[model samples]
Target: MFFILDMFILAGIFGFLYGFLLQKADFCFTASLRDWISVRDSRIGKGVLVLIATAMIGWGIVLTLGLATVGEVWSMPIGFSNLIGGVLFGIGMTIAGSCASGALYRAGMGYIQFWIVIASMMIGNLLFALVYDPWASDYVMEPLQLAEGGFTLFQLNLPFLLIPLVIVALMLFIAFRQFGWSGVWQGAKDSLQDFKGNPFTKSHWDIRFVAVLLGIIATIQFVVMSSISITGPETRIAGVLLSFVFGDDFVYQNTYLNGMFADFPTIGLGPEETLVIFMIVGAFVSAILSKSFRIRKPKLARMPYAVGGGLLMGISSRMAPGCNIANVIPGIGGLSISSLIVVIGMAVGVFIATAYIFKMPLLLFQKMDFDDSGS
Candidate 1:
């Protein structure tokens, strides 16, 4: 049908833009946390916050206009699952040298190591799918939902616009404070100037520029696809592949995998799968065009660490039931309490992992591991 075709086309367009901007900005969640914790450089982390704030503002406006409802808001329990899952995910990303989205983009750039990480991640998901039911029933509490009269920032009686505005102001202050007012103005003026050489090869985009563009793109994604989560496609793909390898009954009989497979309900590719395929293609195109694509092998010393990290990320993502892009981005936009808790847990996980990996004195001092060049 034309409707389905149109959805695929839109998904490709959005996926392309997502891949291109992510590649150009070199925006990896693990790097952002590591840089900030290790070096006191907050540019990348602040850019991520700006992206989240901008998405929140845009989503609010869309809600006010009745253009769309909040879609794909996870109602999982805000308890041990989020805490353990987030910490594991954080540690995993640190080891893997990239988060889920980061791995995808880097894989497109011909990093064979990321390809391995992707494979490990798929296996991890399969493991999670196998164990989710027992784990959820035994450990997870009842799902805490925002839609079912659960607490939310918007419900605090403050003006709805004020929350996002305040968040935006705080994020901007954090982002621009390192550069004095004069420096900020100068940087803006410089960003406006045109490149004198080849646009693709010579030009570099500012983090803020990419963040704003990401916000807009994410908003458009919500309008078109009625959902916005990078991990959804990956998870779905894993389910389909597992089903093929095993039997349909094996996958469908399992509770967690069945829920995932049932969401798509198709033997062929769906919108989420289409988005992921094009996202890789777009990243490949961008890397090639930018002259940055190269087949690089990971350091032998770090292979085990990378595989372990990928496994952790895969299992934790399903346990949390979301990744950074899926939970943090949209969760913050929707003002979910569980999302905030996950972010805190992730930060703690990053801190602990960084201390262990870099061998920092007292676990807080700066000790850069120049020998380890995985990221």
Candidate 2:
């Protein structure tokens, strides 16, 4: 019990730090994608690449050193669900202007719309549960009713780890040529100083600096928790919420829930749920310290978009068997094929959603600045 308590404490600390960094940087994956796709600004997008590269490298070292086992890492399997789920996830995030974790942190920052989004996410998950019996065969894999036909890249016999390493090396070279090592070193120095000072209101760290740190933090989460997932906790929390409406015995009728949430023979809350709960608390603490917590009412016109986006995200998260964190971090770190497919699908979804949202004609060059007021 003390060991579990220790893990929970560690998870909370990690969550707090992550929440602090995310709030300080105002980093949203959707915002980054919108910037890259709509206005052609790739600074945050490039930072994301750096984050991925750093994480890939870190996970490679961990794997090579045998610091983590096969069961310790979360790798999505090869499946069409990844592609389909990514499309829905991308579309939802673009519409809502926040991904799952983004919504959580922003909710902590007192965004009423994100709170509504969170509620809608629970609704989406519950709705999925009600319909899962008929739905899993078409979109999800299972060991119960369905025979899953997919495998992770790590399960392959070839030199799959080298692919991520080589790609990371190439990205490092490109980064060195573009930004130089001295700039990064200087940025790190400035970042540490900023961390020690007034990071809430005033920050001097480059996004790249934060990006690299985020990569390292992500790797740490994997090493400590066996795997990192943002949506798993969401699902578990949603399940807990639904248990109030329908008893646990009745809710577990959805076999998918049985497998995913059940640690042994039971389905209930644990460290994973605590991690996300603390994530929200951490974000709240950050907002309080930063004086950024304000209950801003949602725009009347955008409420539907928020709810709709939340529904899409929740539904797709289960379908993909993961979310942005699931696919973008450890999944990619482990060189999972499903994650790669999901990335392609998400890119395509973002392009289509952003274009439609902006009412932009694809054939024409766009000079209008990306508007985030709706978010």
Best by TM-score: 1
lDDT values for all models: 0.73, 0.74
Candidate 2 stretches with Cα past 4 Å from truth are 1-3, 138-161, 176-197, 200-205, 264-267, 360-375
Q: Tens-digit lDDT track for model 2 on 230-309?
A: 77777778887776778887767777666666563455667777777777787787788767788889899999999999
Model 1 lDDT-worst window of ten? 141-150
lDDT of 1 by residue, 1-375 (tens): 223678888888888888887887787888888877876677788678768887888767766566764444333446666777888899898888898888888888888898888888888888887776666544452352223332346545555567878887886686478787888778656644534466556325667667778888887787667556666577778878876888778777888877776655454467777777777787788788889988998889879977998899998887666788766666777677776777777888888888787644432242334334444
Candidate 1 lDDT (Cα, 0 to 1):
0.73
Error of 1 at 313 (Å): 0.2
Q: Supply every candidate's count of residue pairs whose N, Cα or C atoms clash at under 3 angstroms.
A: 0, 0
- Lowest lDDT block of 10, candidate 2: 363-372
Q: Score residue 99 of candidate 1 by CA lDDT.
A: 88
Per-candidate TM equals: 0.87, 0.86
